[model samples]
Target chain A: MDMKINIAGVELDNPIIAASGTYGFGHEYNEFYDISEIGAISVKGLTKSPRAGNPPPRITETIGGILNSVGLQNPGVDAFIKEEIPFLRKHRCKIIANMAGNTFEDYCEMAEKLSAADVDMLEMNISCPNVKAGGAAFGTNPDTVLAITKAVRTYAKKPLIVKLSPNVADITETAKAAEAGGADALSLINTLTGMAIDINTRRPILANVVGGLSGPCVKPVALRMVYQVHQAVKLPIIGMGGISNGDDAVEFLLAGSTAISVGTANFTDPYACLKIRDGIKTYMEKHQIKTVRELTGGLIVESK
Target chain B: MSYQDYSCQICSQQEIAPNIIACCLENAHLAKNAKPGQFLHIQCGDPASMPLRRPISICDVNGDELTIIYEVKGRGTKALREQTGKVQVLGPLGNGFLVDNSLYKRPAVIGGGIGTYPLYLLTKQLTNASVYLGFRNQSVVTLEQEFCQVAEKVTITTDDGSYGVSGFAITQLEEDHKKEVFDIVYACGPKPMLRAVQAFAEKTGVPCQLSLEERMGCGIGACLTCNCETHEEGSAHYKHVCKNGPVFWSQEVVL
Candidate 1:
């Protein structure tokens, strides 16, 4: 019934970590329950300068999921260190600073700055589709992924996790590029690029026109990609994309993810992570699994 | 600061107006903590199809029963209408309307269409308040008797001259303002109506609080989906409609 997971030397109490953007700075969900019960909290995506984000009608619902083009709206890294870090420091769970940038320099600068600050890990967000530049741009190209990951790796003092884009030709190519660039670990798949249009006005629902899709609808796709990337690379993967329940978390672990991150589920239920953790424990007890590590890459495939 | 998820039992459901249904839920905790402008994020139907929760404003609260009036506008509300037995709700969310009877005696409350539902609670809390409600026509007009019982004066208007005063409600509010100035103006409605109220509040130099709406995700500060532009000077040019406010000073927001 042990739920502990160690990612690149950083130990998590459980495998259920709150994903970036969906959980914000861990302030809102804390009102529902104590945030310390979860494994880790990945704060909202931050940048070198403050981003105003996209215009209104930023989100719309699709079948079993949602499309959002928030465009990395944050108060910049300096403000997060001064205003948010102190609050997160008081908590018992580990903190992962999710950082995005418009250029390699922006990535390196933030890496150097946040590495000196009070955060447990640094997650490079190179797959945000909402931003116009340097987000999905760097993640889709293997050479750019290697270059930026290597550049940020030089400055990041803590374990660096490169979050990959699902909107790519081959996810394993980029996963291999991140591995070659010295990433401590990998996390995927950052939302797929999609769009929704209103029929009456024949206008796009989101002001940005295109957005990233997340929720239960994308679970199957995310699982397939995680399985592919796991076979291609050696780095431990933090699989995320439409994980709602404990069974979903187990699917990710069996697909070869070292840990799992809950995103859209938090919106559906405030106590999603805690419920998912309990669900995992219940599954473990029923199956008589000794440790969570045994569940990783434990898929039973038919032998040829 | 305190909020929890409650599995509320559906005590009764009534169709107050065309396509508008009023449902009373039994939850003592939510009823006691709910304020005037706060809202509840409710999960409708099954989670497989309708994954997101709909944010419904508090219409009325009596003892341990909380009432929410919502129109069947989209798939979410359609799913909500079919709900029976019980529903999961997370509520009394966001900063509610600031009510200080000592500070403002004569208050003017204005609302249009479905927006008038949330104001019922506010009107009940105020002592010397005049209420103005507007709708498309007679078939959509609701809560007339409810407001009449609470407000010192009630003015109902319809755009097509189907019932009550024939014209926009703001026109009557402007005419009423000339005779006796109000200390404060509170409003919630369609954008056009809210825009007129905002201009009116600004021109008269009277303090105003407006309840705004947007397509929301988390119904909390966590998801930055529900955001509105503000006139405040800072790096953050926008405030979340779910957190910073579903209610804000008329002058503070851009509308």
Candidate 2:
């Protein structure tokens, strides 16, 4: 039997979801394949005001992944709800609204406005680098993470998933901070910061100088973080980093992740999610596994 | 957007001298529909190295195949060279040169270095025309026979004086203006070359249309990343080099 994970009272049909910032508004990829196949779609990160993003050289290819510093570029929340929302509402999958706030009021303003809007869940992008404070202060510390989660929880009647940043002292500590502060669930491993240099020109490949790295190279770190965090907190965790195929998704599930998000691979192959979803089923059948839930937390650690 | 892998035969895989190479796409459907100035995004390598696809333009299309020219600058192009026999392309993408099919009496097609690419297609579409091409040296010149086939006059130029007209292509265009009333000028080349064309056109009072290039994301209207400010104002705002343009009236661009 397929296990259903409930966050705040809303039930998700399955744990697999397309992470925000990867699946842009959920319409373009739909043209190539069916959108209803995925359990949920997290629209691109939305903020209170529209952002132009960093100037030229937004993405650069790395050893095992690509480093990107898009700077959370998107239309304002109001415009997203007005323009991109209607097309998404017609789809069968659940819509996870990824919201980012620069300050406390930005968080409250987004939650207050989105609480009345149509969305299955409101994902707080707490891990984003703060322009004023520098770095992701909200996600790095236990105190601010708790405060931001509680503030959004006050007005946000919808399910809230605190998207955590991996650039932290302790993954479990931040997860617990979110759980204690009233987070319905959590998502882990936003891009790891990286930089690349161009030899011929003797300048950085990315104009901003540094970028967030995501791809197969970060999979182990993401998995280890997911496995450790899952053991610490009871909140349903959505794991993501470099989940390319179904086997990778299974490792994430076995590591105690309730769901998995496939990014970067979608850029190379647009039909990534569907392929991973099918790969999961084939792996389960081949291994004689009955249900996906049984595979969750199934990592058997033998004493070395 | 179904991607079918294509293998390049010997003739299509010319060294074009040494470091420079040109690959051909042997797909019947793509070749039939591909317009000059249109480009194809070729997947160079798997993840771990060169993850993104590199965009290369269609140099020429014959029968059931299209060709692309490029110099191996980095790992992606090096990987593209390895795919020598098995190159996979995603287009005929982005709007190619808008053929002046509306009919013109006397037109001049100007090209500079590799910018001579789309002009080959535009000249084919311009029934009665003249071709003026400029390059640093004779070694870099391309499409001499094709331009000769399409136009009555092929005014070739080299800065080193090793070729036909020993000067700039734009200079030749200015000199020829005294010879005849060239109805319109169609061109594509380096930024400085186009800037010179813009200046020359301004001086001679000749109406010219140009093709602009920019690093593109979606090649559609959605991203709004690849836009060139146009003379047009208000809500429609700027012209997208991928969609609304790639082709524009020379004076219409803010440049």
Clashing pairs in 2: none
> What does DockQ give for each predicted structure?
0.71, 0.30
lDDT (tens digit, per residue) of candidate 2 on B1-255: 333323334246566745678776687777887787777667676544555566677777789867777777677878777764555455666766555646557788888877787677667767878889998888877778878998878999998998777878888888887898787887888888888888877877888888777655444333343556665444233556766667777887766
lDDT of 2 by residue, A107-157 (tens): 888888888888889988877542322227687888888988898899888
Model 1 spans with C-alpha error above 4 angstroms: none
Q: All candidates' TM-scores? A: 0.99, 0.86
Instruction: Give me the displacement of residue A147 in model 2, in angstroms.
Output: 1.5
Please give the distance, in angstroms, between residue B105's alpha carbon in candidate 2 and its true position after superposition: 5.4
Interface RMSD of structure candidate 1 (Å): 1.3
Q: Which model scores highest in TM-score?
A: 1
